[model samples]
Target: RFNQFFSFFSRIDTLGLNNFIDPRGYVQIQQIMENMTINRLEIRVDSLYMDLQIQILGLCRKNNIRNVVITVNPGGMIDQFRNKLCTESEFGVTLDVCERIGNVEGAYFGQWRRFWNEMDVYLRKKGIKMQMNLCNDNGFDHDGYARCGVRSHIRCERMDRQNMGVIRPISLSRGFLPK
Candidate 1:
């Protein structure tokens, strides 16, 4: 089913794909991706599949993908953020920085901050460029901000129910992708 689905598109400049799939599907997906001309590939990393993130990174490197944006779910572990596996290409990260705030939120926020900081430092050492964004966990703040100083700028829209995807091109004026 997956191979046939991919056979329909020969080259995709930008695409969004769900990463909440079985590990076995990754190799197949990677093989398909390698044959396409993908300028950018965006994936939302579910916490349940944290281990698969490394494999996805490997796939990106092997395929020589132009740009990759991985939106990591909240409470997700950074143990998969290893340098050796990510030595080839640079990628971006869209993290759920803070969606709710309370006593419990504080602890979670702290944990997320530490996680982001550690990943940030790790990526910096690896010379990998990253783009950071805070998604609603649902929607934007009342002020239409993703968070303090953060604005919702870019989003990848799924084209169909089958997880076929495309990026809704928008202004990247705010310099979200850090240097």
Candidate 2:
């Protein structure tokens, strides 16, 4: 079914699909990629497994897929694992750190702060860029507020430049901040 589905198109400018977790699926995707001309590919994952993420990233690099987006929705602690992300292409990848708005047992900020700090250091050394956001999961009708206890996926990277002020702790680095 996967092969047939992809066989319908010989080329595509953009493609969005779920994460391919199975190893066999990797081969299928490679085959499909060889037979297609995909300018941009987006993979969405709901798992917090860094190993899987690394594998997918490796596959992308192996296939020479330059333009790619990987959206990860970590349902648990991501700091528990120590995974090394290495890439040669600096400008082809973008990392978005999406967080839930509401607090969890009063340790949300502290816990996430540590994760982001470590991630910042690691990714900086690896020359990877990251974007952070506080998203509303329920709907966009709440004026972007968290509703006190609601948990929403924050995707501020999707916002326009004029509305960029809402993303907190904006970095003034050489290549990140807009001039």
Candidate 3:
């Protein structure tokens, strides 16, 4: 039934599907990618397993998928698992996957700071320019923020704007404030 529907919707650029198989049947996904002319793929997975994400990412890379959207519930602590899984994969694959996935564009590392650190280093090594937001309430300081820049640091609302008045704005070369 799905194959028939997929065939009928051959001209579509976006595809929406739900995963019911355990570990997410990759062969079926490969088949769909091969058969469809999809440019954007949205998937809803039952589990937030890192391996599953990696598998899907790999497939997307192989097919040159331009955009990927995934929905997962925040249940267990999968940060460490995700980091390890990504670490084991090829950097080219991971970087390409990250670039193709639009949702990861502005993703900061507020919770999993350590994972963000390793990921940042890996990304830099691969020459992948990506931003990470890593300064929420994760109970530990990973120091990854400092590695990025002082401005990249996450501060409380009280601290963020406290010294705003002390800093002077540079005058423009045009003499006027330009506004």
Candidate 4:
């Protein structure tokens, strides 16, 4: 059934999937990859779990995804992740600064400052740019947005001033990519 659904759109590219999927979700993803045709794929997950990492990498390989972007929380080893998933082409591993910030001492954002600092260095070393989609993590402060591994930071500091100019200069819309 999964295969049949995706088979309808053989020309589709630029696939995106969520993180923390169940075992059945993995199976469905596998089937979708096998059935559909994808090039640019973005796998957004909470943390870089080895299990999901391996699964996503495997699917990308099998489908021959060209521009693969894996956005996970900032903690995983750069070398290890790059070796496991990245290739010579356009591959990026961005640090999503915060998730829910649940249980401050236990979550990734617990060591938020540390995570961003490390991720900045890692991304710089790999020459992979980062993009932040600030979904407003429950009244989290925006002051740290610039420091938290975001390539395009949203600044609301000078709202009162005249002529702030374009917020995000670039166009994120996928106009050129295949449907």
Highest-TM-score candidate: 2
lDDT of 2 by residue, 8-102 (tens): 87766655566455655665577766656666555555444556555556556655554554444334434333243333235353233333333
Model 4, 63-112: lDDT tens digits are 66545554444443233443454333233222222232233332243244
- Runs of candidate 3 exceeding 4 Å displacement: 8-11, 18-21, 75-111, 134-179
Give the least accurate 10-residue stretch of model 1, judged by summed lDDT.
Answer: 170-179
Q: Each model's number of backbone clashes?
A: 0, 4, 4, 0
User: What is the C-alpha lDDT profile of model 3 across 43-159, one tens digit per residue?
Assistant: 544444666656665555556554444333223223453344343233322211111111222333223456556755654464443333222434323343223221122111111
Order candidates by TM-score, high to low: 2, 1, 4, 3
lDDT per model, in order?
Answer: 0.44, 0.43, 0.39, 0.43
* Residue-wise C-alpha lDDT for candidate 1, range 48-130, written one tens digit per residue: 34446566666666655655544443444344444432343434322222212223342232255466557556665665532
* Local lDDT at 120 for model 1: 56
User: Which residue pairs show backbone clashes in model 4?
Assistant: none
RMSD (Cα, Å) of model 1: 9.8
By TM-score, is 1 or 2 better? 2
Candidate 2 lDDT at 174 equals 19
RMSD (Å) per prediction: 9.8, 8.8, 14.5, 9.9
Native-to-model Cα distance after best TM-score fit, residue 170 in candidate 2, in Å: 18
Write down the TM-score for model 2.
Answer: 0.53
Candidate 3: minimum summed lDDT over ten consecutive residues — where? Answer: 93-102
